[model samples]
Target: MPDAQLRPEPFIQQTAPAALEDLRARLRATRWPDTPEDAGWSLGTDLDYLRELVTYWAEDFDWPAQEARLARLPRFRVPLGGLGIHFVHARATAPTTPALPLVLSHGWPDSFWRYSKVVPLLTDPGAHGGDPADAFDVVVPDMPGYGYSDRPAGPPLDSVAVAGLWAELMTVLGYERFGAAGGDVGSHVSRYLGLDHPDRVVAVHRTDGGLPVFTGDPADLTQEERSWIDGAAAWGAVEGAYAAIHRTKPQTAAFGLTDSPAGLAAWIVEKLRSWSDSDGDIERSFTKDEILTNITLYWLTGTIGSSMRMYRANAAIPPAQHARRVEVPSGFSLFPGEPVLPPRAWLERTTNMVRLTEPARGGHFAAFEEPEAYAQELRDFFRPYRTGTAAD
Candidate 1:
């Protein structure tokens, strides 16, 4: 049977009253942990802040309202390669012409919520003070085992395997060719899209340099490259222990997160706060509702374990496959506050570097933090590649 005939069905948000009540019960009965007065966030998530947030979550935060808002978007699920993939398919609005198709891949601790703010901006740039010609039909999918998608039931699926699924997903969506972009784990998935589907991918855009894509003779390394390697080592030593746990003992860690909502929040919220460009106040980047909405998705869906297991699967991919050069036309918009901001030379060394821009602000969750800028980056990068354009 043809892939499209898999019959993608409309998906709606309708959490049971029982589930919401149970969540509140858990939050209310949270086993609070004591903290040192001076520890602050030095040891981990601030207990003082978590107490306030949890209070608000149980007493005032609105999941039904958020769910209603999210339900307004066009969302659907389709059976692809035995996995049910949920996605938002937002078409270009009030388009001056037909918009180009674009697929956005996202990483852990987030589902399709990563691009929630940027969707309207990309789909209707005119409403946001941009040209209508810049609009794009955006497809933001919840990767297998994340959000409403089904957990993988067989052998592990790595980035390359996921890319193959994505290529098929685009085909199933009736797109013969499209542009691609992503960051974090999604950036690696996007890399494989360009690497394996150059014939169908119009162009590739990324926020980070998609590390681990570099491996060669030591003699070929430049001083800047050496510095980047050393800096990455330093960053990992301090900030990458969570990933180590995910890679080495995700099942052990998942036990706590899966059973306790508070535990889940601490594990996920720490990253949301630490990796963002919030300075010291994460609220500056994400409101309490925004943070809880993402956390609630994981808590309600029970996918934290599956999400972390992705790291272990990816770790097994051979270096040769990891380091393959991307030949598709590529562009990048490096954010200053993101985990690793690569030099232009480093980007050029990794892919078929075509366009590169360093935005003055934003971080890993740039789309969520700075929607307009992120939307503009996509518009500018994919402008020349759009099929209806004179250049094309």
Candidate 2:
């Protein structure tokens, strides 16, 4: 049981008008940078698009309306592990059937906002044209140093630490056993939950396992596994610099990003465009408003630096920790646009693989990009495990 003193307090999303005005001033006064002609996102965030985005952010983007929308969700903050962790805890709405408690963790470059679109669908499946039995009492927490969660004053918290925090959080909410699912860094945390707390996490689901970490002889790996390993390395060589920076010198990068909203947007939006199933058209996957809403959250919270520090802490995790395979039943949905797909052989080696899926759409931020399909995948994968009520 959780400590009775550690009760959750209701939280509301409210930013002062002065802060919003200050953001507009900064956006309007952005010092534009030069980009080679015809570079068109190949070099980085497209200059033209960024300029247009900054203009919209300065003049048209409505923060109050978005804040109101976010506040409509059941949000709370609880003092756990000496930090006031913020989360959205919505009960399942099915009338007769009891809902399963499922915790959804979000990765970097996003917060709980990543799962906002799909929360309703999961918490009330019947309302979204799915079975009520599939309902989940959804809990989406902002990882330490992300979104509204408090930043660690000491060393940053890694996946393992965050998983422990999550376990305690579930206990505080009175959920003894539950399911876990996430993508990106969240996937790493979810894996740890299944590993470190296997007795409690019923099953684990993830989009991609963290970068391949094989220590055995190459001869033992299948051809597909070798290719997958090589592919991951190749992708990292070309596109993983952001992560490298996060792991090494996030503070140096943080100064500029913290002061300049445009710089922050360029740093994050580039990944959003490159990692999504947008086909060179980012707006296809996310509207300008949607993009700004996420970026604005980072700016308001002033958490970009602390969030990146998670990489630094995770980089210090020993090789033996990476080698440990999860014992809990696991599911993977390799979305089509995900940069490097973990082959079944690798997932089998790393997890107790029970399900593998190739969804027709989406990319890195699938939950936000294709909420309907993403929600349906969860509904189908966890259906068999939904054996008890939310209060059981």
Candidate 3:
């Protein structure tokens, strides 16, 4: 779709009762895995916790209720770059007038489910107890193969190419210039949006910053930045095994995840528990039902494998292209619990960072876990660039 014409259509989310029953059946039939009593998440996902979650998911968790709530968002699909792009376009109806447009990108193991909580807060800040002037028209897209979006038959699109697709999507939605924000893979996408389409992207915001963008002598970097780089590498050495698997053998892992709902839950819930600011109590970050709903989206859609394949595609990109820097204004929010928290100096020097904040709480899924902070950070960061009719 070099020059794809936009055809936006309303989307309705429905998981067939048969599918729901099938998921329950799968949960019920899960082949148990044995683990040592004291291992308790040190090796991987705790077998006991996963069993507890599976029990709840099979008998108690309600898919229809969760689906109905998610359906309340105004979702739509528009063809862009030879793919069907699904997104929640819950624009701000603030009476202040021209609410700024914001395009949010989601990362792995999750979809638009990530930013659903932040949508209401950003699109209606006044209703959430913030000034109406801070309102924004929120747009959260399911990256190809992640949510209800179409899966690529060939290779999946990488961050740079996906950034191009997003630029086109925003244009189709009539946003000549807008803000871009994301975390995880989304952080990479938002950076590319600022780097590749600076004229169209007013500013960019990210919760995490990764990708080898720096060049020249490492000795020039400050002690904190150098330590951060080394720390990030060490963290990756321990935490990046999943990434390595995704890059090397997503198809092999996808088989079980695609067939067994318990398999899917075990694979994703571990990350949710480990990456959050919850301090090991998973419920502190997300309710049991909330966790199930996220996994259910992947289960019902059968997208776990496709989503994992994106890492393989991303790895194919040349390091030279991945090293491109941003010319547009960039913002960073260093959430306390994210696995690798890059220092402010590293962030600014890496990208054209303007606003940087160390929020007291939240983690990798900050938008879902702490929507208020996420929304407020976005409002504060993009305020300078939102030049239009102010709220009266």
lDDT top scorer = 2
Model 3 agreement with the true structure over 24-91: per-residue lDDT tens digits? 88789889988887999999899989999999998999889999999999999988878899999987
CA deviation > 4 Å runs, candidate 3: 1-5, 211-215, 388-392
lDDT of 1 by residue, 13-80 (tens): 79999999999999999999888888888888999888888889899989999999899889999988
TM-score of model number 3: 0.96
Candidate 1, residue 22: how far the Cα is off, in Å: 0.5
- RMSD of each predicted structure: 2.1, 1.0, 2.4
List pairs with backbone clashes in candidate 3. Answer: none
Q: Which stretches of candidate 1 lie over 4 Å from their true place?
A: 1-4, 388-392
> What's each prediction's clash count?
0, 0, 0
**Candidate 3 worst ten-residue window by lDDT:** 383-392
Q: Which model scores highest in TM-score?
A: 2
Candidate 2 stretches greater than 4 Å from native? none
TM-score, one value per model: 0.97, 0.98, 0.96
The worst-scoring run of ten residues by lDDT in candidate 1 lies at 383-392
Candidate 3, RMSD to the unseen true structure: 2.4
Evaluated against the true structure, the overall lDDT of model 1 is 0.87
| Clash-forming residue pairs, model 2 | none
